[model samples]
Target chain A: MNEVLTLKNVTKSFHQKTAVDDISFTIGKGEVVAILGPNGAGKTTTISMILGLFKPSAGEVRIFNHLPQEKQVREKIGTMLQEVSVMPGLKVQEILELIRSYYPHPLPMSELISLTGLTGEELKTRAEKLSGGQKRRLSFALALAGNPELIIFDEPTVGMDISSRSRFWQTVDSFAAQGKTIIFSTHYLQEADDVADRILLFKDGTIVADGTPAQIKSQIAKPSVSFIVDPETSLEKLYLHTEIDDIYRKNNRVYVQSSNTDRVLELIFQEKLAVRDIQIERGKLEEVYEELTRGTKEAV
Target chain B: MKIFQMQCKMEIVRVLRNRYFVFWSLVMPILFYYIFTNVVNTNPQDEAAWQAHYLMSMTVFSVMGSSMMTLGIRMVQERLQGWSTFMRITPLSDSVYFAAQMVGQSVIHLFSITIIFIAGALINNIALTAIEWVMSGLWILLGSLPFLAIGTLIGLMKKVETAAGVSNVLYMVLAVSGGLWMPLEIMPKVMQNVAQWLPSYHYGNGVWEIVRGGAPEWKNILLLVTYLVLFMVLSKYIRRKQEVA
Candidate 1:
């Protein structure tokens, strides 16, 4: 596979404070990579460097083997930043048309509108008057106007409602299906887990972990089984099993963390314990993200 | 070229749709023209001259207001909201973006000059040949370039509210001191000396020279051009500072 983006020891600093530490990664074409981190983890700073909005303090970033600031390279990239910054007092169609005119070849207005799910009335409405969700949709449309090969979204669904968030991801999925290289930075761990083929967990301006969701999950080496039981049914015999790593009770549910879930199930069945609402889940990416990034907070 | 044209069109449409911008750039200036020439100055002997002078003054006033407040405030707001940064990342070049803004301000300037000229003819019976009218209009439009640069510089340096306040104060001071509202001869000697150093004075004097059927003096042209270059450089420096920040 062709590498679409390459970052080599890229570092960005403001005065004496570093925003993006010396970190490097490569993204192949047609791959969706998510940069997941909490606020101030340098997610936005990294994205800005990729978009050529900021000059890195050290190292390099290359898109299509060219510097990100090159016009030829920028022409093939689209971005939707965290802030919705579309021109005010203009109708949606006008803004779309204006942005489309910037590219050598652009997606047709109809295709862009339909792909972003902009309703006809929304197209006619002034950008400033649109609701928050509608404004986000418009931002998405602008990002896709150039029919970019690489689309970078910085917290694209930050303030969107649940329905709008789902719809936004649906639109993104369709674009990804067309073989577009996608890179987005988001704090929404579930979004990264569900959509990204590879996730880069960032903390303290550095990548704490980088792998597929399953690979990251496997690092913990434990699956969790949880079920609600009668508050009075817990017996001391459950603690005798060495297969379980840890056990905890929250409200009416008992949770078992174990590499061997089958043995735990056997113990529960043999014990004749009344259980309801049973749920078994492998180690989740969220837990792995928390485990990896939690300790590095004070080191920097 | 197409991108430039599209940006211009979008800006024009935005200005037209904004009632507040339209009122300040168009309606208010025309009203001032009527009040100053028709109501304040009714001398029969110098009625035509007063009409022509005030027409040029109000035209300059409107141009300064539109270019500084309309274009400058918009640029500042865009910078604050991250729209300018967004545009910078796109394929659009900085020169093209600035060119588009210049063209938008020029369109507004042209409209203001034409309306004031028409008001001069009908309300004050100010007579001018086609050449004189066209030449004077071009001079006023050209003279407003420094203010456009000033506006862009202020936009880059300050927040939207601060930009608005500074531009308003600058506009009024320039108008009153430059003799756009009242002649410098009526003012004190020290004020007239101060006005000589003001770029607006040179710009207004250049326009008045054109209206009186004389070519603009080279010194006045040099002054306006110097101020334009200074503001342009200042804006560029501020932009670099912002990028670093």
Candidate 2:
């Protein structure tokens, strides 16, 4: 596999707080990877380091074997930051032309328009006069203007309407079809599940999970059985089974997390623990996300 | 080269489309010139020299307004809005961006100067040799370097409102104290003495000498250049400090 980006034990800190801690991930050509995290989880900081907007406090970042700040790397990478900002007075078309001029061989204006789905009237409108959705489209057009081999988007669909969001993903799909490597950070888990070939889940500035969407889901999303239990009923014997993954009490209900819920249920009866209102939960991606990221385990 | 030209062209378009710039830099200065020279003070000994001198004053007034209010404020707004961050990720080098802004602003300064000079010619028949017109215009154009530096320095500010407020106060104080709004001859002794030290006063002084059939004083030229270097160095220092912070 051809590596398009490489980060080796990269760390970024601001003041006394670390933003990204000892993260190292290499992305191959044509790979579509998503960085998933909750707020303040260092996704933006990691992306900024990759784009050379912020210097890493430790370790190294490279693009195509050159430093991220090198002219060669800059020429081959395009980005749209989380904030949808544009030059205030120039028309959309003019902004596009100006950005395209920075590249040696830019995409044709017509192709950019087609890719970003910008209308003729939108193109003529000044940037300050653009509606939020229109400004997002213009930002997308600017990102694609360079025809870069590697594209990074920081929360790219943040303020887009549903239709605009779908169109933006469609454009990404076509770009990926062209074998362009893409890295994006997003809050929407379903979008990552649908779009990304791999997911890097972050928590507290460290990647807690990295795998394919299915692998992550299966690894953490164990089926569980829950039932209301009496307060004095000690559930200690259930802990002897290795098939059970975890156990926690919420309200008067005790949830037994395990791949083998039948065994857990049998153990409850075998131990003669006073329990009632039994229910079972199937594994899900959202649950896995919540479990890994929340990082709170109430062992009882 | 093509990229630089394209960036410059866009900067021109951006400035021209700004109504604030058009109103303050072009319209307000011309209005002040007519009001000060004709409406307020009708008679002065050697009216042509007074007309020419006041013309340079308004020219300085116009260019300074653009440099401080338009250029500086817009830069602050862009940085605040993350447009500067976006540009940094591009292949566009910082040197190229800075050069484009300087050249674009110089072109704008030249435009306003020609308009005000033409307005002076029409209103008061403020006649001088063709070379006088060209030399004074050149001095005004080049002498604005310090004001442009101050504009960039103002851009290092964090907030748009703060930058706008500071530039507004600075613009008025510099214009009045440098004797651009009124002649130092009519002002108090303290102000006259203060004007001797201001870059704005020296900027107008160079053009004033050229219109009076003489070259700019070496002192004025050296002072303007020194201020330009000083402000630029200060801006660089602040920018570095900001990056560290």
Candidate 3:
């Protein structure tokens, strides 16, 4: 696959502070990459640089072998920024039609409405009158209107409800199935884990970890077992087991963290511990992300 | 070209739908024209010339109000709402976007000119040849460029309320101080000196000359052009600074 986006040691600084430190990455055609980080971690800054909103203080960014700001290159890119930006006093169809006119080829208005889940009455409503989730849906529709080859979303699901978020992901999934390049920045770890083929974990002003979701989870390999137990049970006795790394109680449940789940289970059975609704789970991306970012912060 | 047309149509639709803008730009000018010509200056020795002058003044006022207030306030709102940033990332050219805005303002401006002219002819009995009418209208349209640039400059302000306040103050100052609301001869001598330096004064003088069936003063036209160029350059600089920040 061709390289749809390439960043070579790109850096962006605003006065005394650097928003994006030296960063380099490449996204191939049809790849779904998520930039995951907490607030002020430079995820938006990096996306801005890629979208040609700001020039990198150093190094270079190229999209489709051309500068991102070039008209030809921008024509092939669509974006739904963190900010809701629809024009006020214009009907939804009017705004969509205006945006659609900017591209050489665009999706039909009917198709766009259906894809974004905009209802019939919404077509005549003013852009400013839409609710938060509806506005997000409209923004998504605009992003897809251009029939772009690469779509960049910055916190695309920030204000959406559960059903809207699921619908949004389903739309994204369908778009990705068409082999289009997709890049999004988000703080939702599960969002990244669920949809992204690759994740770039950002900390401070740089990427701390970059890999598939499973690979990132494996970096913190300790598995955990937890279950509800009687509040009176003396779970403190399990702390003496050498194989169990840690034990804690919360509410009416006990949690055991161990490197080997088999040994922990054997010990639990031998001790005749009363447990119900037990669940054994591997390290989650959220835990791995916390450890990586927190660990780096302490190291500094 | 098609994109430009579509953008212009959208902008025009938005401005036309705004009740505040339409009332100020379209309705208020005609009201002011009627009150000033009929009530304030009822029995002038040269009724025809006096009526024509006020007509031209009100037309200039209307164009300035529409171009500056409508365009400036809308641009400020767009920036605050992130629409400007969205446009920056699109494939649309900046020139096309600005041209569309200017075209929309000019449409409202032309409407103001027509309504004020109709009020002047019907109620005040001001008469002019077809050629004089066309020339005066053309001069008024040309004189509006500086205000358009000024509106863009004001639009660069961070807050919509601040921009609106500043634009209102500037509008009143230009109208009164520039002698668009009254003749400089009737005002104090010091006021006339200050009026001579105002671009609005030069714009009013050029349009007034055309309304009186005379050629536009080259010096005043030149001054208006200079202010237009200066404001355009300053507006561009401010916009670039904003984008970088």
RMSD in Å for all candidates: 3.4, 3.0, 3.4
Compose the digit string of candidate 2's lDDT tens values, residues A1-300.
Answer: 999999999999998778889999999999999999787888999999999989999999999999988888889999999998899999899999999999988999999998899999999998989998998898888888999999999999998999999999999999999999999999789999999999999888889999999999888898999999888888888888888889999877899999988888888888888899999988888888887778532211
Model 2, B44-137: lDDT tens digits are 7888788888988999889987887788998999998889999999999999999999999999889989998898889888889999999988
Off by over 4 Å in 2: A226-240, A249-254, A262-280, A295-300
Q: Is candidate 1 or candidate 2 better by DockQ?
A: 2
Error of 1 at B6 (Å): 1.9
Residue-level lDDT of model 3, residues A182-269, one tens digit each, is 9999999999999999999998889988888888888665788888888877776688888999887766668799988888888887
Question: What is the DockQ score of candidate 2, to 2 decimals?
Answer: 0.87
Worst 10 residues of 2 chain A by lDDT: A291-300
> Model 2 scores what on Cα lDDT?
0.90
Two-chain complex of model 3, DockQ on C-alpha atoms against the true structure: 0.82
> Model 3 off-target regions past 4 Å?
A225-258, A263-281, A295-300, B240-245
Instruction: Give the winner by TM-score: 2 or 3.
Output: 2
Colliding residue pairs in candidate 3: none
TM-scores, all candidates, are 0.90, 0.94, 0.90
Write down the lDDT of every candidate, Cα atoms only.
Answer: 0.86, 0.90, 0.87
Residue B3 of model 2: what lDDT?
Answer: 93
